[model samples]
Target: MSGMTPDTPARPEILAPAGDTPSFLAALAAGADAVYVGLKHFSARMEAENFGIGELTRLTELAHEEGRRVYVAMNTLIKPGETGAAWRLAARLARRVEPDGLIIQDPGLIDIARQAGFTGALALSTLANVTHPLALEEARRLGASRVILPRELSIDEIRAMGAACPEGLDLELFVQGALCYCVSGRCYWSSYMGGKSGLRGRCVQPCRRVYSELARQGGRPQGKDAPRRKGAPHGRQGEGRPPQGRAPLAKAGGKAGRFFSCRDLELGPLVKTLLDVPHLASWKIEGRKKGPHYVYHTVTAYRLLRDHPGDPAARKTAQDILELALGRPGVKARFLPQSPEEAASPDKQTSSGFLAGKIRITPEGGCELKPHLELLPGDYLRVGVEDERWHATLPVTRRVPKAGTLRLRLAKHATPKAGTPVYLIDRREPELQRLLGEWRKRLDALKEPPAQDTAPPAGGPRLPKPVKPRPRPDMLLTSGLGRGKEEGNRAAGSTPGRRAVPALWLSPRTAELSRTLVGRTAWWLPPVVWPEEEAALSRMIDRLWRQGARHFVCNSPWQRAFFPQRLPEDADLLAGPFCNIANAAALAVLAGQGFAAAFVSPELSRDDALALPAQSPLPLGAVVSGFWPVGISRFGQAALKPNEPFMSPKGEVFWTRRYGGTLWIYPAWPLDLSGQRREMQDAGYSFFARMEETPPQGLPELRREGLFNWNGALL
Candidate 1:
């Protein structure tokens, strides 16, 4: 019996975020129903000060004492060999702490959990791609207790999911956090830019940087290899240059600002509306990398709203406290249009952060910036040029007319031109900081220290028996290339390996070379095909079909109809990862649409992948080697420095590449799981390691060993 009844809707539980001990304590004290924290390693926020494995029992005790729950985030992708280790740890933690839930991103955890006899709840992390009703159904089949919806989904889409949610399944929505412009788990930008793999939780957020776009007149984009300056404004949009004869300087963002830097998703206004939607299990706030003060202010505000929803005065107080705690303006409620115009920060920056108002250059060339909403003394504000090439940070020292405006008095430095945007970035006002301190002090007075569990819970569940290794090595290995030289080599050369390499995954741009290798290899179409390129792709497939090609892969779900529904009995239609298929139901649905086999989401763990085959042999495809792409983005304008690596402030370098007119960023190291052959074979998977792209002159090139999840390192 849960809290809700048929007659009355249950208030959505407030799930707070915790990176370290202080944050966790603050959230619990602030009235959170549950808190989500990361273990020191294998966490998505590897940069945060996560709890040690030893701290789990103590933390669980502390939360449980307050009638609250704890959720451990073991959400990083696990490789085949690494599955056993992760499961063993998870099982041990379960028996010790008995956490409310384990939030997981990988499908392989299913097998591991079964083996460990672990019975704890499993919440599907947003990375698992539980986007549609079909996906929600699939997650339940795989035993997910809850599905965290992707932030990109609209209010209408969320309502539909709620309607379609089956009994016993819960839906979680992200209420506040920094937003990623690209869909979570689907992006490869950080990885392709260098070697920092987002999937492995070491994302160097290149998404936050200042990137300028370049374009010729009439909507033509510059080539990937084009030379440009790092700070030069783009040519030819609405900002400076004209459209036709001249190179029109494009505004990186016109009134819209940074298009790729999405504003935070704050649903303050829609809290009541969402509560009534029904089946929204919890409202989650994402900030494991944030400080304790952020947790305190956010948790307390939400707690106030949840408890006193009917009081207008309470609502006003919550909003005022929220503004005081978060100096940033612009908390976007989802009811607004889901367009870049609405979602992107006006500065085209990662954050507008706090809400300071627009600036007006005084008649004397000095600037007067009025606070747009609320402002406290000692609050820090930034005044910069519209392009952000130059800016200065100043403290709010003086006020005029008590109208929430700050006057800028600079000594002969560059004053930002008139109408420049002002931002409240630092929320370090003395009163706000003291309030946080008081909150923590009061919480300490009311709570006792955590009690540690010295031993694991007795009589852990039985581990499942290991099935015999069932290997299917005959599945054809394939080479996918978008470059011409690679296409020509595939056409002219012998099978890539001494053993037969019988398949090809090719881009449509290489259609001319298809005639040479058409019937010789199974043609698997490119996984990512844009709309404008559909005609060319269809023509290429038709040409290959006429030449006796029998197999093709549909990268997107929409392509299920694009490929023929009826093919020869021996021919194959394969589902791609972009289709977001992670469960048997999605695959079964695809069966009617001509898909004979399917590629499991690469995010699936070895054990999870194995569980699927045990239920039904669907010829699931797995990529065992190759550099995993971390970002696939259309925001492709930028000038390159030497080597063109996406450098992080921490000094890690990720390499970026452009193909099919889109930018790709990959992790510095390739995911070399060649050593995990047993994991794949045991799971009943057909393995494919990406081979050389330029066509192998001799044997197919093998990837060198690199940092992979095989051993569960640093966990």
Candidate 2:
């Protein structure tokens, strides 16, 4: 807030999502102020059929002509090898497409964008983890013009972030969208289970799959009581089998449910409250993967709610419009965290469609349905959620009255089981259809903008110079040992019989121990610090600094704010692994923010990992060995018992551990790169970290088969 000045209050713009051409046209027709779309590749929503460069170029022109803005989403995490291609994409958008803004998740892209000559606003994606009030200034310094606030924040917390936001930096909020069970940017569940990383936008949505919660006993879960719920959908099952030829554990009693499936966030009347929130520039709708019908209805409903909050008739009409939007049952989620509504109800279905009716297969091999609601021609119904084997979508060929039975001949290849749940996913009303037809005609008649030369320079982007090498050696972080007399004489930097330097994980409870280990031991800050925890963390850092701690590892780049303004010139501050630094440009950005070193993301492949250090602008490090968590979450499922191992229907095992106010989930095995230690050292990495995290009791010590993304591609 240094040189920041308040701007005059104005109505925030409504930003809508467009995953396909119809959705884009719908946004334009519905009077949306802005539309956000993704390119075919490098998009976080790869599941969506994103636009091509030429198509986006035309769309940008069309939006501009209508006085509306188009924000291009290239927000996925960038691998080391993909930097050049990403640079070319950015450059092309800057020149030919001329998008109003570029949404990004990777800090490396800050340098890449600047180098690519993109003058558009750089909006940081929610995955960048700018959670606390203190992080906003750092976000601006890192070149973000706007920050997409995380969905987990409350109204009060949002106001706090807005107040701390710097001038010239705007905030975008997800007023309506599908919610993720894990915090954005922190989740590794999908990537950990498979190579499909949520950060890179290839998430397979493991959180939506059904899971069986089991009671833990004797270092494993009792699987005999794992109930097989009728019609429970299945997908990638966990690896490993239950103990063979043995009775189930004595405590074996569990249930199956969609424990992690989250309800969609719909702030229908809540839009009025956000008006009081400062620095808010856009009310974003999330779901680029949704159909045009969803985009049109959602945009219209929000517009009406925002413009006529005081009008009873308009409010009622808006409510009706949203009810017909075909989204999952809406929840306010943690928006009002103090009196928070439960976002996930284990008993309810989490599919994003209207429950039409149960399906009954006739003996003649025809499909029979008792319609719960009136179904007209052009209505689309889905047999089940995507993971189910028989999941399929079909159009209604004829009208069916409410409670009326409708029998239809089925395709020979379609074999739906009896009693299967069917959901009405999409429909086009007569009025809506006519409006869409008009928009399509208008779009088809519009003239294409003149072509421009947008090719990159022959040699591609010039890389920044590497930082001067530092001599900080590899270290193993551990909880300090001993107390009083013997501890006073012990050297905290080195453990007996170990060659690596020693470090201590900082926590409020460890104040006395940290004091004992000060000077010699480097203090590793916690990976996440929520808004409420900020003051205590700041005080702890102040206390530690006064006690002479200088060597520190900040898991988040924003934690640099916790340090004193006037630091010793020789202070060694490092951006830790949780920062997710992957390329040289990201390291350069961190180096400018006063970090002396950083850890490269462990999710990179061998070639990409090895290629980073040579171009890095700060001394680099890696998480060499340890129990790297699958994800960090704010909510611990009520139906799933913590510290007790649970199994996916496919037999994979996982367990959760509560750390402070957050929940951490881990796979059965640990991440071990000890075998590649020599190779890493030879690759010019300045240091390596071996995490000594605590595992739950009853957890077995399995062989370290998890190499993370080191051996395979990080999708």
Candidate 3:
């Protein structure tokens, strides 16, 4: 089937980030086909100056006048009770403002969007991490017009995804900006360390901090004052000096300071390679948190390159704008090779090194050349053919003898001469003559090869025709215990044939609770703060699994990681919001690592949501309701213990200092659950629910009224 129809536009829309009025105006002026922003409750960017009804209406009007579109971000995970509120809000927006699309991370919101009579398109956010073909298909089945592929994928992977994607499903990519190391944008390090939940749109980037790694020998702590190990060279040091003054280091074997900081990714030099990808529909720029100047500069530069390919003047303009906006020395294609310091430093200097042949290192400490002209002892070298030139020294060290060739090594770094015919350096005239003659003979032989027959030989085992691989199932459903105050009511019942609820219930160590529920269900009970107590609760889950429990849920990656793997083969594996799969590549990696399902971020667009289901190799689950936690982390054991509720000295409702930025939390007031239900149903989702909070007493009535359904099963 053809991937595009007459109705499908030849060129994909240019989607831009607009955090406020100024950024919105800049995006329109610079040539953005569409802009995405957020509302107060469900938006992942809590710190952004989000729009209420008035602002959204005004922005939509302005964008329409410029022949541009606007998408609202309502992508935060909703807790159980919050589902209705989230739905209500979405319905109100769709009815009133009528954006071209709604970017959503949760299936519940998708359901609400559709129920509220929203006929516009949907884009899946990167937070959905739609990486596999199955995920994309699922999203397409539901109603996503496009899916934004993860930023971490290599060009080869992107090609594969594009080839497998169904017709009418467009692919988007992040061409520039801060690249997250974590998979699929799902991170919990901030929540664990600073109490900010990235899934709830409040992420205190703990990844940027430096922390000493505790050395464990045979799973035992080595000793006090054990040399601290660093997670990355760029992370922050210590507990960020606390809030008041420098506090004495805790006796917790703290050694290495901060470690994991990385500079943002700049791909101006590699735009040619990016454009070569035939399936790429959109090139995204990261920096919703940044200002208009940065957005304008980056967008304009890329616009020129897209319009005029291979134009030296156009490429030069992009480089200049990038340098000024980044406020650094310049840009560079990272991962292309260089010194260890160059690879690690957050500050990158512009270099055309990626265009050079892949750098190969030998045991003799020399770099090897591939697919490029052979270098002799001395050669002049330069990095870029255009502007932002970077020169280096090159010297040959040794040459190894092969059958009829020499392997030359560089003694010092040097740039290769561009746009040149072959240049031969000869120490001995007779040897050079012989070498040239031999090379010419080999080239002549390669140029003219023996001809082949016109047709293939008939059968002879028929080569056992390769079978076309079947697309893997994208969504899977499993059973778990339901939460409530009732205790062991099933055990007291006399009827032996009564079907019990299939589920796993985690009770507080002090509260003796037991039950069985068929199908996956989770309780958002307050977490147990003590490690020993948490361990005991884990043991109870083990015991319950033996009693027929099939699925379990935890709030932190560490908690899920530590859970004992004793369940049956039919058990379902889910990475809670704490796991934070922020990009499509991360989701693909996670699926390969064996997660059956994941809770998507609320920051994704409707197109993103549709694309995720279509691309994912596993089922995509959505968190619909309850109180959403703002900041959380997966890097360490530090958990943000809220000292107060929605009121802090920082003049914010909820704030956590985990990663580099301060994550602010807010409460969502949903407008229509019915609309969210329809959207999810259209997305081909087999499951949907509000995970963390209590459902309203009228939820059952709402469900009966066609408000919620999981794989056609009424809630």
Candidate 4:
């Protein structure tokens, strides 16, 4: 292990994700500048193999000895009741491993770390959604030393944001791996479509699934009287357009459906631009869930490019390895400074792996091939014929290379016309099989025998006690108008013995229009505001608070960090779903931070919500019924006319609105928990029912009704 000596050149860090011990070893062997790992619990990648606290000493010590940094991701949202346990774990990690940085997403977790006197650096996770320079100020206020910028940004946007790094916080970019269709923090598609949440690390990847739209029809148009909604000004290409550049992955319901799937991030060519950006601290690889082979090859290519920028031969060799390693044609950086085409449509949604050769199935059976590239016996073959969008992957039984036409053995059932194109699936191959073993040995020699690990037994920390909540049949009702006439109707109509609270979310425009509305009771503020809206919003809050406004709801780390100092300590602080609280530890920490109540995520199942009461450190509330926000987008136009729904090819219309650079997309289906209210009360969590702006006519019904996570089922 090398020491961090003074004479060592300060190279830009290459951050890698290590899902488990073996991956961590691979990262070290392949020259990762730093390694990020997760604890067995509370990490965003819950499905991956993770390290428990007992293994921390070994992971961190090894990285430190090698003069490389190690960061632990305690990045998931914590429910109110579970905060104590999370804090205890964080405290234990901080006291023991003393990691180089604590990469986190939740505000409560940051409070917990500070409360426990954690002195190490804190890196804000992408789930925090720091998309602008102003947000970096908010991050600094929250004690973030660095921010992992979201992957949705264009290279131009990255450069613009990176220039501000010297002022408040350092910036990092995702240099490689699977790209999410929705912006990291803003997406709720998985939670809505599948019970699994991308935020909690149980994403079912609804974006990756195939969906063919049955039909399309016109939806309600925005009335002329409504506010004129717009998106980010155009970039010569178009205004807030669909992601620019790249071709579709595979044939979908044509190009329109292809917009829903994203090409994996492969920035080898554009990485030079990332490196050119001054003050950009690190380039991160995104796969903690990927296997060891993927990590090794990826790191190796980047290392070669990073060390020898001008060597074309070295660059070509590295590029070939990357192409073969990628398992498919790598997605070029269309949005980068230079590219072949204009940023128009999306890249192919399907990746067919590595191209083997052009092939044909002869009448005598077996297969004929051009044998252009190397192929191993174990590799799987995907045949795609030009005549049709024809594609099928089969195992390669044997390969006997000859001249222009070679002989190959495929499955007996396989048959394709002559001159059909072929691809080889990325599998164990001779090209890297021997190298893999060599790297494994090198990794083994770095750490001593008898794997060093010591875990504190359960009950080591004074965790918050689990107690059934003291039920007080109090329910809060809200409406669409961040302050409208129908807003307070439900809460104001509570019957005797039931304490109903009237709360309204107000915008700066609404606050100015109706001084009476902003002058009094409980009100919630928008989590993210445009720069121009900030002054007005600040003044509005000041006036409202002086007039005795107490209850407020926040949904971002930025808001949490900024709002506390402005509002008095006596205010009843509440958190919205963006806070992502789903367990007891999350609730306990928020309560400790002085939040009066926090909205439990709709992603929680009936069982999960019911379980919260026993561990809830503060009041638990649920939006029983309303439009579910599925995405918080920073790019693309969602031209939402107030009260009108945006229709999809699937025939579903979603209600949407724009706020600054963000567009909030809400599906038409209203999440209804009315039938489960009694059961929820019994579980001791407060219920907040949302009434429509204009409840539909004919016996009063919404277009669609859903149970959200009431069933608590996860895939």
Could you say which candidate leads in TM-score?
2
Q: 1 or 2, which is superior by lDDT?
A: 2
Candidate of highest lDDT: 2
- Order the candidates by lDDT, highest first: 2, 4, 1, 3
RMSD of each: 11.4, 5.9, 23.0, 8.3
| Deviation (Å) of 549 in candidate 3 | 17
In model 2, pairs of residues that clash are 219-698, 237-650, 238-652
Q: Residues 95-189, candidate 1: write the lDDT tens digits.
A: 66678888877665655555566676788787665656655555565667788887756577678778877777788888777676565767655
Overall lDDT per candidate, in order of appearance? 0.57, 0.77, 0.46, 0.60
lDDT at 33, model 1: 90
Q: Tell me how candidate 3 scores on lDDT.
A: 0.46
Question: Residue 692 in candidate 2 has what lDDT?
Answer: 57
- So what's the TM-score on candidate 4? 0.72
1-715 per-residue lDDT for model 4 (tens digits): 1211334344557888889776687787788889899888778899889886656566677778788899889887665445667777777777677888788877667667766657777888888767665566667755678888877667776777666554545677887776665678767877786577777777756544333322223232233221223321111111111122211121212213333445567778557666666557778887787555567677888887777777887788778767756433345433453552211123342443555677766777667777666555655556762113335656556654533565655545555667666755445566455655665565455544233334442432234665455443333433334334444444555434665555555565445535555433456655445333555666776667666666667665355543545456677777776667776555666665566677777777777778777676777777676555787654443122333333344444444455554556655455667777778887787646353322111111124447776775633
Stretches of candidate 2 exceeding 4 Å from the true structure:
1-9, 215-253, 397-400, 403-414, 449-457, 467-471, 478-498, 564-566, 700-704
TM-score of each: 0.60, 0.90, 0.48, 0.72
Candidate 3 lowest-lDDT run of ten: 695-704
Report the lDDT of model 3 for residue 65. 68
The clash tally of candidate 2 reads 3
Candidate 1: regions farther than 4 A off? 1-9, 214-259, 307-312, 327-341, 346-349, 352-715
Off by over 4 Å in 3: 1-11, 213-258, 276-279, 327-715
